[model samples]
Target chain A: MALTGLFLCTFLLVHLIGNLQLFKADGGMAFNVYAVFMTTNPLIKFTSYGLYAIIIFHAFWGLYLVSENKKARPVAYAMVDGKANSQWTSRWMGVLGTIILAFIVMHMAGFWAKYKFGEVPYVQYERNIVDGSMTYGPSAPIESKKEQFVSAETGMEYTIVKDLYTEVAVAFKEWWIVLLYVLAMAAVSFHLVHGFSSAFQTLGVHHSKYNGLIKFVGIWVFGIIVPILFAAMPVYFFIQ
Target chain B: MKITLKVWRQKNTNTSGQFETYKLDHVSEDMSFLEMFDVLNEQLINEGKEPVVFDHDCREGICGMCSMYINGRPHGPKHGVTTCQLHMRSFKDGDIIVVEPWRAAAFPVLKDLSVDRSSFDRIMSAGGFVSVNAGNAQDANNLPIGKEIADEAFMSAACIGCGACVAACKNASAMLFVSAKVSQLALLPQGQPEAKRRAIAMVNQMDAEGFGACTNTGACSAECPKEISLSNIARLNREYLSASFTAQVD
Candidate 1:
């Protein structure tokens, strides 16, 4: 669970960084192009499969651990105060994990599935070579899903691809969708606050010399920065 | 002080238990928690009733014999003290105190408020000791240890084998206890010869005992009477991992 959890944490950073393209001023061109690259690149495509498996495995293994823990103490304490010693996030990892799992499914259904198999509108971006000015609109009817062309007449480069950016925009247009993503990111924040450092401890990596660094990266980087940045994408689109 | 006590009453390990509440009046605020229990037992005996069963040897904290889940905490609400060391002054008049035995499959209740912590004994036997050559008092002076190392080892050794950590853990994990033993021995040169094997053997026994795995919740340390540090658990993990990966032991 620790190794797999760290793997997922690394993936979160990569995913968050890649998705930061959404914040670019380009009309989703960079994000859509980046999305296409992510799905089509053989190495990343292969890694995505492993990522999916790891996510599922992490969730199930976590639940199994929970069951084993429960079995260890079959009879619950009649009047125990759980809050006395432990942090709430540390104790509710399973519940928070379950929420993140559900959120993953919902998130994939909304964007990933749509980009892969659903009806995503296509767009064409035309950029002038001289001025670096760009124009994008619905692609002229074409059989190819994605194509890049340089115009001979006006020295313009045109790139046409599936408008996953539009798909993102359309999805985030709904207040509920934005709310769900924000809430899921909050769950992600809570999950990592305990999970990041806990993983290191389980991996036998705890030491006083490095404990502070581990905790700082765990809480500030994974728990705060990563989730906030990922969350900002959807909210940015919603409010835009 | 007048206090209501809700004590768990169980006939045996195979039998189920229920909460039996008894009202104790004129309880002295100066009395220890166990002494308060003694008062309740005396009252029960006078009324021609069976006295409550509990585990206690030395009336001091060093015995580690007394085990109770008082008001949801392993050793009552006070920190850094066993139930025997807990005073009734920590509570107020008309307070309801709930007391029960350690709840873990590994530590089954022998009767009301007394659990069989023999599993801990088994774990101790597994790898908690070092095989040292029998020698005279010169043995103590022969091996020298750094003060810092000795202090750390002593901190780990302070674990009294009171099953409070297990009782306090949500997972009933014995990580703190096992790690404390492992950490203490591994810190000393005398224990270095078998440290690898000891780590593996003790961890195997811990797993065999059906204690839950550590989730790093910090409850075990927080509720520990001796305040055993969680760093010992980290060292246990490191030692166990090193053993499993590199140890030559079978």
Candidate 2:
């Protein structure tokens, strides 16, 4: 469970870095090309399968831990000072995890499924060449896709990709979508705050000399920085 | 001084339990909490009624036998002291003190405030010892343990196996107790040979004993009579992780 969880943690950082391309001034071309490259790259494609397996493994393993923990305390204390001992996030990891799970479902349904199998709208780009003009369409087959091509009309090379930036902008334009995204990011932040250092602790990588550093990074980096970057997306799009 | 007591009473492990109140008049400020209880019991005996039962030994506080939750805090409001050491002066006249046993699935009420802590014994037996062949004892000088390390180990060794940590924990986790034993040995050279085995075996026993996982709750240390540090638990995590990964390789 620890290994899978940490693996997913690494995945989150990489995913965030790639997704940040959406903020580029280019009309979704950078984000869309990055998305296409991620989906079509053989290595990334294989990693995606592993990612799916790891998520299921991590979630199920967590359920097992939660159930076992529940059974360990068959009867509840009548007067418990829950805040006296631990952080609220540490105590409510299961609930926060469940929230994140729901968020993942909504995310995949809205974005991933649409890109992979659902009928998403397409964009067209026209380029001039010395001899002839060229027209590009996103609705073309995957095998026929090109990063950049020379136009016959002007003999100038132009790069074209899908308009995922526009797609995200359109989605975030709705108040409800922006609100849900922000709320889900909050859940993700809480989950990561407890889970980040906890993963290392569970895996037995802790030491007196460096344990504090691990916790510090977990709190400031994964807990605060990652979630802020993620949450900024919807807010940025909605306002813009 | 006069004080009101709300104490948990149970006939046996299988029977349901409830709070039974008793008022004590002429309670002396100098009397220990248990002595106050003794006063109440003596009064009950004079009245030809069954007295409230609680576990206690070595009232000076070394023994972990005394277990009680006073007003929602384990071992009463006193810091770094057991229930036996809690002085009645800590309470005011007409104060209501609610006493109860350690409430955990692993710890069932055997009577009015005494709990069956034998599950802790089981976890201890699982891996809380070093395997030394019976023979003449080795020279103490030969071990050559560093003083800093020895001090840390002794601090962990001070754990009385009291379930204050478990009681204080929301999850009823025995991580503090088990970690104390594990870290005590893991820090010493004499405990190296079976360190991995001890880590894995003891943790597995802890799981089987129905103790919950540690969620880094600082309550165990805060409420500890011995003030055992939470660093021991971090060491336990490190030990368990190392042992698990290398178990099959061995």
Candidate 3:
């Protein structure tokens, strides 16, 4: 679970970076384009599928362990002391994980689902002939027009290029939404701060000197990058 | 000097605990923190009251038995020292301090300011030992280990099995403790044969003990009386991974 959780944390950095494109000046097209590129790319597609598997496995195993721990200690400790003994994040993994899960679900529903399954109007194009000739004539004028189709059932006009990325920006760029993202990311960072190094230990990869290097990398990858990437999106939009 | 102390008191492991406040007067500044507690206990005995119960042995700080949380910090505001080594001079005459036992699901409190740290012993029992045959002492010159490795092993082995690392961690993780033991042996040739089993058994025991995971916050080392490095935890990780892989391949 720690290994998978740490891996998910690494994925969050890349995911957040791609999500940051929503804050670009170009409404949501830049982010939408980036999203399209990500979803359609074969390598990214494989990684995304892997990410889904990791999340499920991590969450399920984490839940299993938590329940097992709870069962181990049916009663609370008597001393009720030692608040200084452990890291804040270590004690609060379950809470942080739940928050991250909530945010992820909302995120997927708002952007991913919309882009994949939401109905959109098809693009229409028109070409005009010049000088009543099949081919273009000298000094002949040519005309071109574009149109959008509206849904007959819903009576709503929607563009095929509906910027789902723009919708995400509108939702997440709000102060509260951005704050939620930041808070969730902070929890993620804390979770990673411990999870990353601990995963290697649990997996039994101790090597004295190199272990220190791996821990340093864990801090950089999880503690720094995850929060920064998630924070970037809100900052990008809020700055302007 | 007089100081106010709010010490955690609980009837037993099954009962809820609370901070019971007590005051000590004319405590000597030169006296150690435990000495201050001695004064309080003396007063309690004189008053026909049950004195606070806490763990301490080799009050000189060699034994990791002296564990407590003082004023939201381990070892009562002093850095790099055990609870027994903390002196009253670090506080003012009228300071109000809060004292508590190590809080974790794994380390249950036995009574007032005392917790059962046998979980640590269990973890050690799982994988902390070397598999050496029973025989007479070998000649010192028989096995020639380099000075550097020997020194490193000694440093790692210096950990006194104190639960301070667990208390100092926000998650109450025993990573530092487990790492220290694992690294101490893994560094030496004597511990090579059972290194794989040791790593797996120790980690499994740690998990079984319900200790929280390490978060690489470095808090454990900071609060460790011996100042055991966080690098030990890393070494434990590497050892566990390599051992598990080797075991799988075999």
Candidate 4:
């Protein structure tokens, strides 16, 4: 469970970085281009599919272990007292995971679904096949194609291809939506802060000579990367 | 000086509990916290009120029985000390002290400030014993253990099973208790016979007891009266991993 969880944590950093591209200055085009690349790339497609499997397995197994632990003691203690010794975040991983899961669903629906099947209005531009002269305007209805080249602003109309940076920027610029992304990232960060080192410990990687270094690295990876990647999204969109 | 005591009173395991307040007057700063509790009990007895029930075997701190959460801190704000070892001078004259029992799902409160820590006993029973048969005491020279391993095992064995580690832990994890038992046995040659079973059974029992998982917070060791090391938990993890791997065939 911890191994899978740690893997998920690693995936979060990459996922957050990919999502952060949405907030780039070129509107949503850069993000959409990145997203399109991510979706169409065979390697990313394989890894992401594996990532989905890991998330489901980790979540269900974690819930199973929690329930099994709960069943060990059927009765509640009369005096509910230990608040001094445990970390607040460690104590509430389940709640945090649940919240993050909800946000993940929302995030997928908002962006992943939109990029995949949702119709996005695009501007059309006429281009001379052999020459550089062209007129930019609203293009005809050209259905989304898989791995096919398309102009960022003018969509499929421009034979001269462009990236989807503008679409990504536009998607992330919304204040309320960016706020939710930030929150989800925070949850992911907090979850990773404890989960990363814990996985190593559980996997018996605790050698006295190098355990400290390993834990330190784990802290840096989880404590720093997830939040910064997600936070960069809003900062990039709003500031730019 | 008068101190307000908010004590957790539970009629029984089935019934819910609440904090009941009592006032203690003219408390001596020189008295230990348990001594102060004794004085209050004396007053309660004289006034025909039921005296507060709490667990305490050795007031000298070696027994590990004086487990109490005083003012939100286990063992009452003193580091490396049990509740019995805590001095009244640690508090101001008019301070209100909140006393409660260990609140983990495993350690159910039996009465006012008294919890059933037999979960520790059950966990220990799962694998905490050596398999030595009845016989004459062996000579100290029979088996010579390295001084360092002996010292480490003694430190781990110093844990009194007082449940203070759990009370001090924010997650109510009993890793300190479980690890101490595992370490104590794992350190000696005599413990080798059942080492793997001991680790597996005790950890399984610990999980079965509904205690929260250890997240390596180190709070349990910090608040331990005996100051048991967190490294023991790491050792236990090693033991558990080895045991689980070997047990795959068994």
Provide the lowest-lDDT 10-residue window in model 2 chain B.
Answer: B133-142
The weakest ten consecutive residues by lDDT in model 2 chain A span A138-147
RMSD, each candidate, Å?
1.4, 3.4, 7.6, 4.7
Tens-digit lDDT track of model 2 for B48-159 = 9899999999898998989988888889888899999999999999998888889888998899899999999998899899888636767879768889999999999999
CAPRI-style quality class for the chain A–B interface of candidate 4: incorrect
User: Which candidate do you rate higher for DockQ, 1 or 4?
Assistant: 1
RMSD of model 1 against the true structure: 1.4
Chain A TM-score for candidate 4 is 0.77
All candidates in order of TM-score, best leading: 1, 2, 4, 3
lDDT per residue as tens, model 2, A1-240: 667878988999999999999787656666877887998999999999999888877777787878877777776655666665568888888888888888888999899987777765555455555544555556553343335666666666576555566778999999999999999989989988888887776665667788899989888889999999999999999999
The model with the greatest lDDT is 1
**How does each model score on lDDT?**
0.93, 0.84, 0.74, 0.76
Expressed as tens digits, the lDDT of each residue in B148-174 for candidate 4 is: 999999999999999887776655778
- Candidate closer to the true structure by DockQ (higher is better), 2 or 4: 2
lDDT tens digits, residue span A1-240, model 4: 767977886777687677776644433444545665788899999998998888778877777766655543344443333455545666567767887888878877876777677765554345444454556433445545422344556433342123344454666778887888788778877776777777777665666788787777666777776577677766576666
DockQ (Cα-based) for each candidate = 0.81, 0.42, 0.21, 0.23
Off by over 4 Å in 2: A125-147, B1-3, B24-30, B46-48, B88-95, B133-140, B245-250
Model 4 steric clash total: 26
Among the numbered candidates, top DockQ falls to 1
- Across residues B126-199, which tens digit of lDDT does each residue of candidate 3 receive? 97987677367679788898998888899999999888787766556789999999999889877988899898
DockQ winner between candidates 2 and 3: 2
